[model samples]
Target chain A: MRLAAIALFALAIISALGACSKPPASERFLQDPQALKRGKGLFIGTCGAYCHSTRKDNRDAPYLFDCEWRHGGSDTEIFNTISTGVSNTRMVGFAGKLPDGEDDIWKIVAFLRASREPCG
Target chain B: MEATVETAVDMGSELALPEIPTHWTNARPIGHSRGPVADADLRAGPSAGQWLLYGGNYENYRLSPLETLNPATAPTLQVAWAFPTGTSGQFEVSPVVYDGIMYASSSYNRLFALDARTGELYWRYDHALPGDLRLCCGPMNRGVGIHGDTVLMATLDAHLLALNRLSGEILWDAEIADYQAGFSATSAPFILKNMAIIGIAGGEYGVRGFFDAYDVATGKRLWRHYTVPAAGEPGVETWAGTSYENSGAPAWTSGAYDAESDTLFWTTGNPSPDWNGDDRAGDNLYSNSLLALDPQTGERKWHFQFTPHDVWDYDGNTQVFLVDIEHEGQPVKAIVQANRNGFFYILDRNTGAFLRATPYVEQLNWASIDATGRPVVNPSAVPLEEPEFRVCPGNMGGMNGAWSGALDPELGLAFIPAIESCQHLQKGISVYADGQPFLGGTPLITDAEEDTAYGHISAIDVATGEVRWRYRDHDPLGAGTLAAVGGIVISGTQDGHAIALNSATGELLWKFRVGGGVRSQPIAFELDGTAYVAIGAGNWTSMAAYQGGTTNIPEGGNLFVFKLPAGS
Candidate 1:
């Protein structure tokens, strides 16, 4: 019984250290290249094709590449906005719509951030 | 013929009228006593120097009988007058001319009554739109329909409004559908008998597409024909699960009517969740197809699917042209259409029998239609989630239904405004919301340069589906064509030029820089013994998206009227 408790303690310590070392969900997608590529595919296929545009003078929907953020600029805020869409507008929430669920959305956000220039 | 409104009230002496401009000296009197336009007049096509029907006639020929400005005299034509609508964005409205007045609708449902002879605006009516209204495309009102003294207009907020012809006052308004649910009307209402028929647009938003007929006397709906069938319906078996509820088959363009056969032929757009067809399997009926129905009862007579299980957003809503062609050595009534799927199709108008379909555009790699007119899609063209596949004609299509075609029944030629391009289609994921875009994939433009995308006006032989002649251009042709008598076919370009081509041969006759992209249909009419041609000049969202590099073409709405300068 004492030996089992020691093993449990060691496992808990290892898990804690791993959790502390891991990045946030918002930032984790940015670090991975495959995630960014997948995010780009999703971004180009979904957002760029239909509503939002890459051009600065997109008249139908909001332009994403620009610095002006209509909803929120933070990664979490963008994720939330994407997951639960803005009301009284054409932008609908895409929570369970994506194939990879939240991971796909995080990758999309990471792709968007990578494409965007740093805000002053 | 010019006259003044001399009104004497309680005063003994006659009141003086306003001084008329010198240009109005030779103009005809506004609101002459020619009687109200009857139902028979609408079916008679353009006559007596008047244009009452939206398609110029029920056959959607868009041809004018005026021969004053032929190919020989077209070069001498000068701008008679220009009326600026003062609105931004593309102006695609073809003004309805009758008696001596012209009725035109601009973007955002703004209608105007102008003196056909002079560029004087009698009145203008600006429609009140909702604040939170959702729209799939840009806010555009194609044109208006005229029945008696009431002018009919379909708005972007999903409402059909009746306005008084003289005063531009609102007569009555009827809700088409809920705008919040992504239902909107952009096509000009077609006046048939005593009913005004109009189609709804919202395939991008996954709304169940429908075409409706409203009583002209009262704003009550006569009947509604849903493009996508409901559960237990005859065509519902084509869809999987309950996907037919929001499966799009939007009849978003004007239809052609045959008085003899008593049939109304309308075309439908792409199915919803356009890219990935995994959710809804089987041949999605009615979507990307042509539907023939009873005009009065709205009962489906027959339907012909142009693209079965269409994953390529190829809308079959091009302008329907009713033509009588010699088929198999017999004169047969045929319905011809330059479809967005890069094919020029001919079908029996009496029966929904497919005669032939030939490729009208250069780049068509997705499928080849079979003997029964069903497309044999290439397996590689099927959209997948990860790897992108190349498909010709793209989403905008080889020929967009937005820009209409002109059919010259006399010459047996149909002038099609065609775009040649291919797109890399990649399947994406989509979710259905009340008013959200339901696109399940993205069609990425392959390349703007390297001649991958361009526009041309192809003169197609109606019977054989052969390309008689083609007038090529750098930019995609966005304007509708107007075929006038004297062997002249008039069309506009994206780079701000109104051009005239010989109908028999594709020879350029006259070209005028309109100072803006001419994206509207041209109408020809005669007033005071002079034939005049008019077109709307502007640019829109799709033109900007398709155009590459730098463009100097300005964007502004203006109605330009041209005529031969004082008896050539």
Candidate 2:
């Protein structure tokens, strides 16, 4: 009887944890094998060396995976900034420049955001 | 009965002068009393006995009324003394002295209090600065302010600090703005009754700019007025969209205050993406504007936009001179601005009403005059392709190197250091990622042979809106004007020469060859009844980089004090 009670408590805890978990996305484009591969290629080609690459010397531009950004770090803010350039300094808007359009910009933003997240 | 009489005497003594409060120690309030009028020329000794306020009595004419140096006897102007700042950085700040104590700032963030008579350092204050902080411009502090016993100064890292005049201890320190976004302070703090006002620099680095005032005693932020209004604000519609949020409107230079009107007048720099306006369209209200705000509340009373939709980086950073002038036979409070866009603007000080706008320099192709006396900029001037677009007065305009210009009340003329150069901007489409975007434009070199294309000095008649006279030089560098008592105008140049020019004719009166380039404004003062002129000369990095030329001139950061031979 004692062993049965203990088993029931463990079962109840597991059920509650399962219920609290997030639901699966209706659509997950980032998980697509081709899209993820293409996204990585584009990020490396355009922004990989400049933003992702770290230098032993003084930093001219900030690192992408760094804890702080001179402007902002949120996913939406980064996406918007990337699409629309900052004024004055050399941040130009890429609204019509990208081949894949807004979708490509969004992909890059998602990758950057995910890279900043801690291990789950 | 005797004790009661003694108590009455003590009460009488208490009412006599009212013991100065503890907070009132460093406060030196110069009451707003009208001093003598400074003359246009500096040929002789300062007029009578008036030394007046910093920059000589509120008008900021910077002209002394003394006439001690004569052009005929030019050789008489000799080095009176040399005060070593004891630092390696360039010294761009002019020293302000009161009661025989001189206050000045060195390039590397050191403040010195020196004895006026002997060039002896009384005390020094070094505000600790961070190592990794990037300084877009050089580390320069213009000067310090003296109110009571307090010396107020702004740090390059955007901090306003008040120091005890007797000792070099910091009384209070307050941050002006965030440094990460490229915001910094280089202007000297102007101290008024219980308030210290300061402006920020960083138009080049794409920072949102504004000016703020703080409580003189406690360093409490009193009010902040943004040069560029945000979304839902009054000037939001002027911007095409949300780009106005980060528009660059730096107030890098000091402002002038009118005591009677209780108004502070300052100029703002150009809009962000400095050379391009494709994304952020419309006039971009208040970016390149002269703003008048209430000193107490920091509320905008009126604004006058000098350059609408400025794409040439034409900052209205020239000193705004507040003068009461007779216009059309009527007394009018007017403000005159020697604009960086190669133009002279005179406006009604009270209402921000347009009075007159005229070209102060020789060459300009970007704009023409409209019905409202505004520059109707040609859209072609905007960079669309990589073709070398010829634009005048180049990036550096009518007045560039330093804050040039002095109000000559004697002649009612504004003496300005004018440049006569043109630049070719190569514009093309550039990619934007996480780093600095290549904003499709670069400064192109066209004619390196024409050295005179870089600078000149001109005196403009404020009433007639005409250039009375001009002195041109082949060197690309020149200093701000200092008008003195007689009829002399003292100015310096990058060629390592400080000259006293005839204020009326622009003829060279007296010239002294300093060791290095004279970038600082020469200031004249009387100590122990002896008239002296002090200036700093040194090679700066910005000037060297912009000129794209090597300077063989020895770098000099020492202050040279000059005076007329004994017994004028």
True contacts kept of each: 0.29, 0.00
List DockQ, one per candidate, in order.
Answer: 0.19, 0.04
Cα lDDT, model 2, residue B284: 89
Ten residues in sequence with the least summed lDDT for candidate 1 chain B: B20-29
Instruction: Compute the DockQ of candidate 1.
Output: 0.19
Per-residue accuracy of model 1 over B299-342 as CA lDDT, tens digit each: 98998989988888888898889999998898989999999999
Score candidate 2 by lDDT.
Answer: 0.66
- For every candidate in turn, the CA RMSD to the true structure comes to 9.0, 12.6
Q: For model 1, how does the per-residue alpha-carbon lDDT over A62-120 read when each residue is reduced to its tens digit? A: 77765788888878788889999887666767888777889988898898888896677
TM-score of each: 0.88, 0.74
- Candidate 2 per-residue lDDT over residues B233-340, each given as its tens digit: 898788887777667788887777777787888789877656667767889888889998888898999999988887777888777787777777878888888888
For residue A5, model 1's alpha carbon misses the true position, in angstroms, by 40
